[model samples]
Target: MSTPQPQTHQQAAPAPNWQSAPGTSYTSPIPITRTHLGHALTSEWTKIKSVRSTMWTLGVFLLLVVGIGLLVAANTDSNDYADVPYTIPAFFGLILGQICLITLGVLVVSSEYGTGMIRTTFTASPQRHRVLTAKLLIFFVVAFVVSAFAIGFVGLITSGMHGGASDNKWGGTVLMGALYVSLLGVLALAVGSMLRHSAGAITAMLGLVLVPAILPAFLMMSESLRTLGEKMTEYNAPNALAKIFELDSENGGGGSQLVLLVGVTAAAIAGAYALLERRDV
Candidate 1:
């Protein structure tokens, strides 16, 4: 035959079914449904430790808390300090430590954004809140470890630095400072989750965490600002929390300070989570 005749419409061969293949056409496996908080916590813990900044920031926190405390102790004369109501040097050290806390807090959350690994974290965790919570727990636990040694060593070494102005240190002020840093990490997490930029989040945190402390001095009505300043200072919970640590047991931070910090931290975290849910990942 010169050429095969074209099949008529009725005789046209049936089309092959491409839908069914040797291994059925890939149907994407359903994404894992639930995210376990414990799983997320463990994973986050690993992420924090692996990062270099975590180590460096942590090192600085310990160093300053100890070194400055020691130096302050060695230098200040008891005679001059006796008249001062507050232990200026120790107070100064506490304030300085907050600087380190801010960096440590920022890195804990902001690093994910800086490295673009947060997306991966979200991918694996899927539940944003769970991941965030895990992050908080992990940050706090590590902060606790760091704080234990950092606070204890600083406290003991700086006792002499107190220059006879006695402050037993609050029951948990040292721990509070650590928790504040950790919670600040949570605040950073919220901010970072929203901003997704390390520089911006860190800048925001500096303002959010530090400005209130400095603002008290700059206020126009110094005498009138006593109450207002007290209220505003709580915004910088770390520093306020640090003050609690600087006080003796006779005048510990008491409920008011603790309540103030808890209130502020709760508000910030709540606001952050709400924003996080509404914003694009």
Candidate 2:
């Protein structure tokens, strides 16, 4: 009897339902949410803040702007403020300081390309324009805020040192100067996006900054090109910043400079967007 019972092998019980119906969707235990521009912006902000280059570049910018401004102020008499706004000294520092900002702006995009991380970024976001927009917005805000703070600090200290010399609407000029530098940084960012090479993009930006200032002199020597050179000299980054800081009254006011920069930046940004969509990362 024991041999007969052993011959009847028991069949295993069927497993529980482990698969969903063909037409039904499974709800994941983890929360699933759609991504938006804010998420991309947050991601970009995190990336920008986490990198060492951001700190190094911005720190140098601050050092150049604040240090040189203070040094110039310390050496000059209060009477020097009679002809120009107290903020004039900051202009000298910003000329060099803007190079730091331009480098940072190029790094913002070109660095990702250099490391081949841009592919990962695109894979995660899948929306190229959104990513570019996030980069532009985050970079602009950061550049603007830091620039404004540095310029304002220098302006206040200089004014105090000069016994609040005639105001000359110094507060407004501080904001304008910050905006100008920030836009330049944005333009640099757009250029980086287009070039996708750090050194090349940076070199191009430097040309944009320094060429106009220097080339105009040689062009003016050639009488045929005098008007063209004049326009370039009038609208170059340094001249624009100088006008904004009230250091160059011979040139037109900062408003026209801002307008020219705005137009050029807009065109560059548009071109960047076009290239980003058509080209493979």
Name the candidate that leads on TM-score: 2
**Model 2 per-residue lDDT tens digits across residues 1-281:** 35555567799999999888899998889998999999999999999999999999999999999999999999998888886777777888899999998999999999999999999999999999999999999999999999999988988899888788564778877889999999999999999999999999999999999999999999999889999999988888888887887778776668999998899999999999999999998
Residue 31, candidate 1: Cα error in Å is 15
Candidate 2 local distance difference test against the native: 0.92
Candidate 1: misplaced stretches above 4 Å? 1-35, 76-91, 158-173, 222-227, 233-242, 246-254
Clashing pairs in 2: none
lDDT of each: 0.64, 0.92
Clashes of 1: 4
| Model 2 error, position 143 (Å) | 0.3
Clashes of each: 4, 0
Q: How accurate locally is residue 236 in candidate 2, as Cα lDDT from 0 to 100? A: 84
Worst 10-residue lDDT window for candidate 1 reads 81-90
Model 2 spans with C-alpha error above 4 angstroms: 1-25
